[model samples]
Target: MTEAPSPAPVRIRPEIAALPPYRQGKQAGADAFKLSSNENPFDPLPSVIEAMRSATAVNRYPDASASRLRARLAARFGVGIDGVHVAAGSVSILQQLALATAGAGDELMYAWRSFEAYPGLAAVAGATAVPVPLAADGTHDLDTMARRVTDRTRLILVCSPNNPTGPIVRQDDFEAFLARVPADVLVVLDEAYAEFVTDPAAVDGARVLADGHQNVVVLRTFSKAYGLAGLRIGYGVGHPRILDAARATGIPLSVTAQAEEAALASLDAEDELIARVAVITDCRDRLAAGLRAGGWNVPDAQGNFVWLATGEQTLEVAPRFEDAGLVVRPFAGDGVRISVGEEASMPAILEAAASALSLLPEGHPARAM
Candidate 1:
């Protein structure tokens, strides 16, 4: 029998057609530790679980506005209810803000090697992505970033404790950078891993917002610290007008009732949740110390992950981790990111990292003195 011919591809935006889909971290098998995604290894508190279980009314659409959750967040952040906006996740809010602020020919600026989603968010809004390379130490060079801002720039994303590479932007540096940015241009401080930060000098988005930076919006998530990754809930705090614009661009009812309930429960259990974060941070510090002791030049890991700047050896070293019952995130030609998992996983992680360090040349950048 003759084979049928394939149908013609449907028309779509060429830029989008050329864009690569967001790649999730690799999954691990039964015997392996999944340290690819920077997920909280702690189990959800019983209160949060109960809250989710109580949200049994699946027959009804969620509050389109996510009012109660917004109110709770507003109170916590000392902002008016309108100043807070809830969404399926902080990334969803990012896309909404991009759509609200920029379009074709406009520019959305971010530090490259930060969040992997920033460029895709810009592309989805039909805006050009302006990725400023990170400094030699893997932190955002805010001075250089501020200098790069142009008239066409409509949105700037600042990721603290930046993903993959983990150093944070200092508060003083962020303030200086903000001063240089045009007031009309929106700045979204993506603080997805804010709760994990232990540095006293790291930029505090809430403090910035409270200081009357009306052009700035703070994006945070329940996914990381709260162990609500499966629930898909997060919020943005900013001027009411700015949040309103984001709301205009958002999909109505995207934040589900269960997610809102779970978020509320997490907030109620903030003390307990924060205790868990301390444990994770301790684990993170130990992991970083272990990697550095192995002669690997690990960055200042403020997030729950350590970066191995494997450079060209990223692809080659990733499987070595997999063979040792660990799954990690690897950026080809750049580096590998290993999340701080259970304390028990640390021995294997350190062992794998030490073995991988031997593959680098004598004077590689990822090697420490």
Candidate 2:
């Protein structure tokens, strides 16, 4: 008798396969300058490195609770220990949030062309992802987003200084948006680049949530401000009960000892970090100006990066940058997003933008054609 073929082991969820992979720009070549991921170009503060070195104890497991780091974060944010929960990174905390709240029948809502992580997390939790389009100005259309929140929507993600767009939601507008959203719907304000924001109207989610709002949570990362990207430390602050539930669902021992030490030291060096952020913001503005001078439709950047709103696939322009020894992020169908990593990369970025524009049609952002 013919042997029966073994059945294929079923994948965890169909949605996992359906979701597109997060595309990253190439950096394999020796001459390549990778600016794809939004990582700090500057080395970690000397004090931060030394602190991590002092805490490197390989044989022992990390503090499962990350109590000291969490406590420090709580003090820094002026929140209680119960309100703050530290994790491997802010992305990790976001993963836990999706797993804990969204499931097979639920939906996770966020802006399209935002952080690519959200849809992946939602898929892993067997949930549907609802992506709303941004306004013509590339800002979240809050009115439309509020309408998208149905009974099946369990989580709403707001990325202020929104990735790629770099615009913050005005405080009054956000409060009005919050007022319209149902209390049961969890609203996550991702302020990863909050430190760089100079906009007076930027919504301080901490203030809103701390004022007794149970539905809102604020996510911040040490990777951006403290220059601890490799160490991977980030946190979420919200209602104590909400954090408690999230804590119960999180992966144990996510924060390492070295990260804990670096985070604490970085907090101690807040003033210095803030100054560095200002430099980066200046760089971002400089980049935006340079692009505009070249006739690119560059948007106002409120973060450590500038965005070139080509409103086309980034892959089309990526090769031009690659040829010039720089690797910048390219979205498949949207526009190119470039991070202002260092003072040195500015010239290269401008050259690449000029080259790429030459290849596109008229009225293109770069006018290279």
Candidate 3:
């Protein structure tokens, strides 16, 4: 039966109404390698699976504070119990931090082409998003980001090994940038991919926090390195007061008991989990090197992904990879991000990248010098 068309959707914030919903990585067909999300290609540890099985208490709500998981993370980072907060995912913590710090008329600043969720989080808080464009090599131009800050700026996000385009913010550069930012302004070091980094010069957020960056927060996740993406658990380490503010904004009991148990188990099995990360990073390096050898200007990828700055050709180039049974993430008019997927997918990736490279116009920036 034809019903009255739902009266133009209920009134909502104009900014949020204007914003686009967050888009996830495309799912691949059964025969295709899903390289769209920068996810761990490894299977979960049996220990983690067993923990989840034992944690089956769907009939009851989870611990609101996730105390045990928080305690473990706190001990690992030498932080106080109150200073550690666990949430559904590190991305959820980002939104919590945004809501806790920024509001209407305030500003949430970050690098462009970062995690796609950043803008929507800011909009949800009724805060203005100030996105500083990435440098030509797709790294954050911290100097300019610091300059962009003003009295209205309440929060800043620094995504190391910047997503989509891979490059870590060097320790020297980050410290210099931090010095210029006001002490009151909160800076979140989004290190979801920290485990994959091999660069000695990269800014280790844990070290930076220990060095006493009072306003700094370090966010990490079991979703990426620990293969807990399906479980949805991550943690944040920061000043107790800052974490308290974020904790207050969180939805009670959103983190499930199963997720918490899997996280604890993943922590117990961290050594083996990290070895899997090493394999992915090794694969990432090989992929980046192969792309470079083929005259594609791949960045010094420290994450489990490689960026193909296909530029304006993204729309045309991404589908070619898809045709080769590789589903990749493409940011139209910007570039394509190809995650380092299963080892079996490597040959397809290289072949697709080589073909995409041949499709680029003469003198495209993505072409090697």
Clashes of 3: 0
Q: Which one wins by TM-score: 1 or 2?
A: 1
Report the lDDT of model 3 for residue 225.
Answer: 87
Worst 10 residues of 2 by lDDT: 360-369
- Candidate 1's displacement at residue 168, Å, is 0.8
- lDDT per residue as tens, model 2, 285-332: 888888888877766578777776665646677778777877777776
What is the Cα root-mean-square deviation between model 2 and the actual structure?
4.0
Candidate 1 contains a number of clashing pairs equal to 0
Clashes of each: 0, 4, 0
How far off is model 3, as Cα RMSD? 2.5
TM-score of each: 0.97, 0.93, 0.97
**Deviation (Å) of 359 in candidate 2:** 2.8
Tens digit of per-residue lDDT, candidate 3, span 287-338: 9998899899988898889999888899999988999999999999999999
**Model 3: lowest-lDDT 10 consecutive positions:** 4-13
- Model 1 / residue 237 / CA error / Å: 0.3
